[model samples]
Target: MSVNSRSDREREHFNALATDLGSVWWGSITKAGQLRLDERAKLAIRYGGLSPGKVVLEPGAGNAEFTKRLATSGATIVGVEISPNQVAIANERLIEFPKAKVVVGDINKLDFPDGTFDAIVGNAVLHHFDLITALPEMLRVLKPGGSFFFTEPNMLNPQIAVEKNIKFIGRALQNSPDETAFFRWQIDSILKRNGFSRIWVKPFDFLHPGVPDSLIPFFQKFSHFLSNIPVIKEIGGSLQIYAQR
Candidate 1:
């Protein structure tokens, strides 16, 4: 399928998912599913030096759960979501937050002005786009010295590749496409080309897919330990990157 058609289908899928969540507590249950994920995300943000009172933009703020958490830190939060239904649901979910806003738009053609935010953060969002277009756009909206934080599935990891291939093959058999692979070197080069410095990459979620939910906390601790080890850090299930523009 062409990128345009695939993007359209993805928008429809996201809309349906958002509507389903809206009908059932507007993502409260879905947010619960994100607890483990959020811990990882927060750890990345902390490592990236995210500060209170800064203006932050979250591109592809899927259920806006992370945006809500950022808002609670007294930061001004702006979330850009590709799905209109998701934007509406995020707005409703974050209504009580005085420092939060949501916009329905694509990150590749972000409508925000240059130097509009102090930091840009996204999780599990970039791999959805053609990276050549998306990475430059992300840099364009960031101010000089602004931080960029992103987390993506690490295709370089053996376990991640196996789990992802299983999902990809299943989707392909159903005539659906799953664009979730990563090119680690290409991503690093793109960040460098965009004039971002102080680049740091860290691996995460080493024990996620194979572990049971009840053991997530213990596994997360083990994953953190493994990520801190020299030889194994680059081979985890996810990669979290932080850079300064």
Candidate 2:
């Protein structure tokens, strides 16, 4: 299938899953799962240097798990989710924050006006779309000097691929377009083309081979510690990038 077709199918798959599951795996679990999510959210916020009274836009907010935390920063938070069910869940999750708005929409065709937000954030979402088309929209919606922060699975991590392949084989999945090592490079190029400056990339959750889960707290912690080391930090489980328009 073409990229466009695959994207549509993936979106449909997620929408159905969101409707049936009520919430995505990211927010429905507890204990170490919640901790992993919270840690990543905190890291993104810290990296973005989010402040009070700013207008923050989160595109592709699955279940709005991070949206709730973003609201606590005293920013006016708006989340655009492609899945209506996920948007509904996000609304409930963020109902206390009157300034927060969760809308069901496509990120590639966002409805916001140009230069509308102080910061744009996305977590584990960009790889789902063709960056060539989607990234320019991300840059266009940001105000001058505004920041864009995103966290994506690190395809460069050898262990991650191995695990994904294992799951693929066990599930009889074939021809799945797993994230590639070139994703970071492609994104960096797109950011540069879109006039974003001071791009910074950091790898996080290095020690563990797979997703940060209950069975790997010690390993995750060890990896987190190693991430601070100069050389080891260059390669991690996820690649986080921050760029200013």
Candidate 3:
């Protein structure tokens, strides 16, 4: 599909989610899901090198969950989302966060000038776009030495592989028409080719948000243990991407 059509489809899909499910479509409404968001937000803030005086760009800020959390660090955050409905929800979430705001825009055609941001952070957002085309825009917006952190689906994982490759499964899972998962090396190589340095893409996150609330802590510990193992670590459900420009 052409990029324009793909973006239109993304807008439609996410607008439906914003209208029908509000912020629950991506599984952040439950207790375990909330914990997962908290962990992802913490990782992004810590590893993305966000600070009080810095300016950060958060692309595809659906519902602004991460944007709200990022704002707590005192950094100025500009959140871009393609879906107007989703942007409305995101704006609601950031009502009290004067330092952050969500606007409807395309990541591939960002409106900012070069070297405008100190860092970029995203959560499961990059895979929705064509990485080869989108990474350059990300690189263009970052100041020298600026870094980025993103958590995306791991194509190596069994469920993610199936979800990405199988049409029926992906539709049932509410995936957008053009969204796909990525291998760690795929993203690492793309970042390298785009002139990013200090790149590190590691498979991580085994705890599913659907796990029972009572079992969440146990699974969290198990995930931590599994991360330390060699081969087993490669099959985690998501990839943690950290890189500098």
Candidate 4:
């Protein structure tokens, strides 16, 4: 699909979700969902090395769910989203955060000047675009040594493999028409080709948001254990990516 068409689809897909589900568009409105969101934000902060004065870029900042967390660190946050509806919701969620703002724009063609950000961080956003076309723009906006940290769906995971590969399943699960999951190696090579350095792509996360609240404590521990097992670790539900430009 052309970039324009895919962008259109993304806008429509997310706009509808924002109108219908608010922050719940990404995860259930439950303790499990909150846990997942908390974990991702913590990792993003630690891995992205965010600080009070840092300027961070968050692409696909739907409803500002993650952006709000990033803002709490006192970093200047500029969130970019394609859907105006989602942007509006994000803006509201970030109203008290003077350091954070959400703008409607395409990530593949960011409006920022060169070296505009100290780091780029996001959750489940990259797979929505063609990295060959998107990464160059991301690399262009980052300072020479700026880092990137993201949590992306792992294609090796059984559930993700099926959901992404089967059109009906993906649609039912609310996936944007063109969005897909990724293998760690694919992202590693793409980052390298796009001139990013210090790249690291590791598979992690097995705590599903659907797990019952009663079982969460035990499941969280078990999930951590599963994520550390050598080859078995490759099938984790998410890939933690870190790279520097």
Candidate 4 Cα errors over 4 Å, as ranges: 24-28
Per-residue lDDT of model 2, residues 1-245, tens digit only? 45567566556756766776666553336555556667777876777667787888888786778788777778788888767777877888787888877898776777889999889886777766667667788788889889889887666677555645576641232212433333467667877887789897777765332345656778766877987887576567778888998
| TM-scores of the models, in the order given | 0.83, 0.83, 0.97, 0.97
What's the distance in Å from true for residue 47, model 1?
Answer: 4.2
Clash numbers, per candidate: 0, 1, 0, 0
TM-score of candidate 1 versus the correct structure, residues matched by position: 0.83
Tell me, by lDDT, which candidate is best. 4
- What lDDT tens digits, residue by residue, belong to model 3 across residues 1-245? 67788888999999998888987255677777788778898999899888898999999998897789889888999999999998988898898989999999998799999999999998889999877668899999999999899999999999999989998999888888888988989888888888999999999888887899999989999998997789998999989999998
Task: Give lDDT: candidate 1, residue 133.
Answer: 68
Worst 10 residues of 4 by lDDT: 22-31
Write down the worst ten-residue block by lDDT for model 2.
170-179
- Against the reference, the lDDT scores of all candidates come to 0.70, 0.71, 0.89, 0.90
Badly placed stretches (over 4 Å) of model 1 are 1-3, 20-33, 163-178, 207-213
Candidate 1 C-alpha lDDT tens digits along 1-245 = 55567567657767876775552122124333366457655764675456677888888786676677767667788888778887887888898997888888876678878888888886666766766667777788888988888887788888557656787653432212445656567667778886788887766657654355678678768877987898677787778877888
- Candidate 4, residues 23-49: lDDT per residue as tens digits? 525454678877878888999999888
Candidate 1 weakest ten by summed lDDT: 23-32
How many clashing pairs in candidate 2?
1
Q: List clashing residue pairs in candidate 2.
A: 207-223
